[model samples]
Target: MSRIEVVAPNLKVRLSGVTSTIIQLVPVQARSLGIATLGPGLPEGLPKMRWWQVPSLLARPATRRMRIWHARRNVEMVAGLLLRWLFRAPMRLVFTSAAQRDHQAFTKWLIRRMDAVIATSARSGSYLDVPHDVVMHGVDLDLFHPPRGREDGFGAAGLSGRFAVGCFGRIRKSKGTDLFVDAMIELLPRFPDWTAVIAGRATPEHLEFAQSLKARIAKAGLSDRIVFLGEVPDIRPWFRRMSLYVAPSRNEGFGLTPLEAMASMTPVVASDAGAYAEMVVPGETGAVVASGDGPGLTAAIERYLADPGLAEAHGRQALAHVRRHFPLSREAEGVAKVYDRLWSAR
Candidate 1:
């Protein structure tokens, strides 16, 4: 078991959920793989100081004490470069943002200096100008697998009779939740049994926008057709209740919710952003829409809602895709091999 330290410094609530999923993956399968955090409140119940500032705060001598570091996100690059210089901590930087292209050259340069790299998808791989490997984020098939309705609260909440189209993950403009809501308004007349749900935490910047969304529901006379269940600790129960899942992200390194939806056997309609083109496989595993196309989202949602057998077919195909290309063991093994190769080079 090789110990690896992950240093993602996010104070946001949503960061914890995603990072926790990653931290649990590398260590559990890689035999004692470990993480050290540097930032304001990390995503998981991580053990370490708020390392968000550690890169900028560390004294030269202090940095020399550590051996390996994992920098999370592109924003942390400056600190990553400084630490690499101070400690020679053969670091492996992970990037999930596709929003920045102007810095790609510099990012590529910095990545090449690192011992190795890990990309979540081919789009994510393009950020690297060095030796790297692709490791699809692994989902706990058991935890997220076809969720059983052990309790009735999720269903009994009166969302049971409708075609539930739920979206999960951080709520923000980039996530395109507003666009999803607009599409929901369009579908209310055609599909009276449809409901759109906004799950996960929304940023303070978007809180007013969420209110506007709720107001739109009331104004459109579709309050009965839409709902908002704010952030919850465990998503399994929520995922279980969903009949169809939607993703309208302006961007994604890789959308984990769609896979979670597939694991739950809920059908998916997603924006063709980042890795969705490769993973979703329109008309096969799931339906996909243009990033901001409300009509496309509405049309795709209607298609899936109108055809349960097709939804099941696409969902089954999605399950098979996950089992073949993105299983935890496959992802873990790919990453372990990369670690082995990097160590060999050292």
Candidate 2:
């Protein structure tokens, strides 16, 4: 076939938000355009180009005047710059910024050289000095849909709990894992039927932090009520098992776990961090509390725990909200428009 017209470089060996985005979006994007990824750590099934194929990019594609190089991280941005400026690749450099924090001098310099820029959320866009388009991340509806029945999820998890409340993602201070644990300790005793589940792993550097939370749970004598499932292979089923989900991150670029949970028919209690405030409709789909405010998080979570019917109603609304506004197809289409505009300009 057809020559590749788009190159999405991951450039990271470890699993991260950027890597996950590439994995989820590439297949949907590939259906519309000639797109392939370049990097390590990605699954073998995804369409990928080897380092040996880098030389081929120096020439224009047969069907297109120039290819698009999409970068989500600093290293990927630097790689795109090297390919276009140093190696004279016939490509247009594009960088997607998910950071809400002010950019460093070096990062600003790197961003200025990009041919096009995309921000994952409006808040993330506000931090950028350069002109950019806002394209929010979306969840895969097929992968994270509602379970057939509540017991279906409970059976899949093999947990002994009438109702489950979960918090997922890396267990770290920044992720606010301790806040979730604290909330569970205080509330689980009141709601004897509810169980708290924490999924995700703590890296070597954060092992002590994770252990401390577990110790806290043991001290509270709620270790059996509050469980930890480290770095699950698939989190969708776990999401379905939850009566409510908590995203207690102190800070985030553009968090997708809330949307994922919402898509899985789980109501969320998220913090103001990331685009959570934008995604969660206060008093509707879910509640949005201030970041790092443990008391506020506890109060918000208690709203759902106190009333299971409210949680189920919100979960239904959340799934509808995500389907209408945050489907993977919408994100793929939005990015495609950016690509189309760049190609049209050429």
Candidate 3:
């Protein structure tokens, strides 16, 4: 029998850096301040820092970076709490972006007891009555910038140049990819020239769903109407090719993709869920529809599809919103400040 013990150390620290892309302007700063991160796919460029694998903690029984624990998802918080209890240490847990922040008393209380708090969106911060920081999750600004060609390339991409709607990212129910598909099915007949390009992989459930969606499109004889560019590793071209972007996610702690699409100068069509309200302004930077309503999604998409020249105007507004609100270094710097403050206190 091979067994291992994890000594949670005098001060156990947990870090979930799954969202922190190494090249992003902010994460570089957090690592410099010794924020021990644990999660999948850490940036290889990070220095020889003490990064403990949450699962491998059982064998090490070491506790060096156990002072300031920060995470993004609920799963990360659970792992941090267990580590703190196992090590008999006082933990300062900070969840970067949480979905169930409204009615999540247990999760909220568990995190509030910690020394500090952080939220990625204003809505997430609004609920808490504590000393909290709203540091949005950032994107690779260099990678996602104003698209080239017509600034309206949708014209060339088999779209009417008036109504080219695009949505990318993993195909899933939560992402509302299904909603987008259904909306397109209902609206495409009215505007046969309008195109909806669905990109990215699908979950097992949605794999079948994706197939069904494809079947429906084919059955409706819309093989050319709705294009499926599945799982594109290089999404820049897709962003550049579309006049409008769509995100119907059921929920999001912080919708970074819309930000990325905005940064790429693509006007958005998103549900008023999670970070969409903060990012997309109805009839402004982008359009917003009621959450869980397929008709709303259809109407919002059609608004931009109806007027693609507004794409440039709408995209510029979206870009300006992102520029004024969320800068790249914001999240990492806030996280760094937390570490500096905590470290200095110690």
lDDT of 2 by residue, 1-346 (tens): 1489999998889999999999999999989888999989999888899999888999898899999999998888899888888999889999999997999999999999998999999999999999999999999999989987755476567777678999999999999999999999999999987999999999999999999999999999998889999988877789999999999999898999999999989999999998899899988899999999999999999999999999999999999999999999999999999998999994
Residue 298's C-alpha lDDT in candidate 2?
A: 99
What are the RMSDs of all candidates, in order? 4.6, 1.2, 6.2
Worst 10 residues of 3 by lDDT: 1-10
Residue 308 error, candidate 2, Å? 0.3
lDDT by residue (178-241, candidate 3, tens digit) is: 8998888888788766788988887676788778778888988877878888877677767867
As for model 2, its CA RMSD to the true structure in angstroms is: 1.2
What are the TM-scores, per candidate, against the unseen true structure?
0.81, 0.98, 0.78
Q: Worst ten-residue run, lDDT, model 1?
A: 57-66
Ranking by TM-score: 2, 1, 3
Candidate 2 overall lDDT versus native? 0.92
